[model samples]
Target: MAKEVYQNRIELLQGTLDLLILETLRWGAQHGYGISHAIRARSGEVLQVETGSLYPALHRLERQKWIASQWRLTEQNQRAKFYELTTAGKEQLVRDRSKWEAMVQAIAGVLGPVPEPEA
Candidate 1:
């Protein structure tokens, strides 16, 4: 059987990833790869969370206090640092989610409904 190749072209805008990363932390503290997998799974494989992007975002969020990290052993027994959301992170998530929703709604209003083909 031929292996299926998945292409991920949806580029996440600057700072948008920070919001998603913070939200993912809300579930619980998770290591880098775990965070990537969680977002991909939650997004139903639509969003390809890349490690290159995710690591920097995680560090940025840590510096911003939206998340905090601590070194710990992974389920596989490897040492890794896990990140978790702080109180501020939760509050920020709510604000970000609202803003994103508004932006989406505004764009939808401008785009209008799709035209249906004649029967």
Candidate 2:
């Protein structure tokens, strides 16, 4: 029952995961687990990225040359692949951020501020 509820949970928009992953890497290189944790933490735990989406997105970004990955030892002395944003990724981040800002503004305009409670 619990698993079913989790499986039915809403996820990030179709392509927003790419932008979020790129944004997280802006800080520096991070392994897959670290990236997911960072996204959840930064979003105040509101967003939980499923591995099913994360690995594929990471691979897609790597193929697009937006991010590069290499194997390294973690603080735990374990081997892991760390991904870092490339120059192109940085540029894409700026573009994505601009689009996101515009999107938020448009949505806000539609929703409008809550009118003060009818006196």
Which number leads on lDDT? 2
Q: What RMSD does model 1 have?
A: 8.5
**TM-score, structure 2 vs. true:** 0.83
TM-score of each: 0.81, 0.83
**Residue 106 Cα positional deviation in candidate 1, in Å, after optimal superposition:** 0.8
Report the lDDT tens digits of candidate 1 across residue range 1-119.
22322222233364578778888888899999998898899999988788888888888788889899999999999999999999988999999889888989989988998778899
lDDT of 2 by residue, 1-119 (tens): 98766654533364588889999999999999999999999999999999998999999899989999999999999999999999999998898888878988989988997777877
* Candidate 2, position 1, lDDT: 92
Query: Over 4 Å off in model 1, which ranges?
Result: 1-12, 114-119
Any idea what lDDT model 1 has? 0.84
| Alpha-carbon shift of residue 7 in model 1 (angstroms) | 26
Off by over 4 Å in 2: 1-12, 113-119
Q: List the residue pairs that clash in candidate 1.
A: none
Q: Model 1 — which ten-residue stretch has the worst lDDT?
A: 1-10
